[model samples]
Target: MIGLILAIILFNFIAFKTNRRHTQNSILHIWLFTIAFQLIFDTMIEFKYHGYWYFDKEVDWLGLLAHTLLIPPVNMIFLNWYPLQGRLRSRILYTLIWVAAIMGYELLTLLPEPWGYFHYGWWNLWYAAILDPFLFYILIKFYRWIRSLEERI
Candidate 1:
């Protein structure tokens, strides 16, 4: 968690310094996609672990919400920091990074003996494996849409 936070900060710093051409709309769209993805995935995990019932625990709920919101912004920061020149290259890099990060997180979760909020169930692993490609495709499509809109203006 600490490492993730630090990485986000560092990425943001570099992105802001270098990617001055990035528009607010681009950033917002990226953030929206990220938040939506996190919310969906986290909700699924929560349901699998804690059943259909929701919790009144403010801390847990807030933490989940906060992380969901943070996902896109952090992702945007990294993507902007290393802005890809071509669509194909961007999509490939995006897919690779997302997969790598998810795998690393899963590994960390498994390493500390049930230290993570979500367990390494077969379903969860399968979900994670499938989600990366889906997210990459969605992000690429969305990014192209945004670029087209920008060109029209």
Candidate 2:
């Protein structure tokens, strides 16, 4: 868990530094959203398993923070590589593609033994299955709103 947190932080730092010129705020927002989701998910997992949860766990806190920071870079990379631009149709397509990619990553946690980062169980799996699509939709809408605001500015 510590290692994962460190890795995520390192990756986020690298991504942020590399992309500082083009879309820092957008990427930051993505990172914030990702982190927020992770926190909520983490809380749910802890409540289900441990019966209680606290951020006093240094490693868990670090992991959550790192995961949040890492999200922007990961999503930014996806968007840049795929180049989502132009019409509403294209935007929807791009958003779906991102949703698919996020789901793919989440599914990877299920392969073999449950990856320690994400608890692998029926409830967690179901939660993720439901959560990902909703989150993706919200994210897409948020992105659209941000874009519109940028245009107006």
Candidate 3:
């Protein structure tokens, strides 16, 4: 659980410290959206199909910590630094870099019990590498939509 605790602290610290683009309202929206989105996906992958799970393969508070606190800040960091106005090549490259970093982080989460909090069933790093871009695409689209709504208000 130490790994999970450290990640929650570091990711949230960096997210709040480094973010300059989003307003307070937008950050709140993004935080809630990320948590809800992750819950939906996790319900299927972690519970239904048992693709993978955090801490354990059953519903627990530690897994909730991983879902709510650990990931949304990372999403915040991702959207905060995303090259929104970059050319297509740069945007794609940026996404690729984030994907690689996420994959590496996933590997770290798989280390062991006290240090590592992640577990695999039928899932693998390749699966994450393949799916992360699409997940990021959805997140970007959602953020764009949120911005559009905010602009009109």
Candidate with the greatest lDDT versus the true structure: 3
| Model 2 stretches with alpha carbons more than 4 Å out | 1-22, 45-59, 79-100, 110-116, 124-127
Which consecutive 10 residues in model 2 have the weakest lDDT in total? 50-59
Q: What is the C-alpha lDDT of each candidate?
A: 0.58, 0.56, 0.93
In order, what is each prediction's RMSD in angstroms? 4.8, 5.0, 0.7
Model 1, TM vs. native: 0.62
> Higher-TM-score candidate among 2 and 3?
3
Enumerate clash totals for all models, in the order shown.
0, 0, 0
How far does residue 127 in candidate 2 sit from its true spot (Å)?
A: 4.4
Tens digits of per-residue lDDT, candidate 2, 1-153, equal 543455466666766565633365566666677667666766666555543222333346544554565565665554444444568687667766766766676554434432334444335445555666576666656766666676687
RMSD (CA, Å), candidate 2 to true, equals 5.0
Give the clashing residue pairs of candidate 2, or none. Answer: none
Model 3 earns a TM-score of 0.98
Over 1-153, each residue of candidate 1 has an lDDT whose tens digit, in order, gives 444344446556765567655698887777777777766765665554542221222236535644554456546655554444668777577677878776776555443322333344334555666777776666667777887899899
Clashing pairs in 3: none
TM-score of each: 0.62, 0.57, 0.98
Residue pairs whose backbone atoms clash in candidate 1: none
Q: lDDT, candidate 2, residue 101?
A: 66
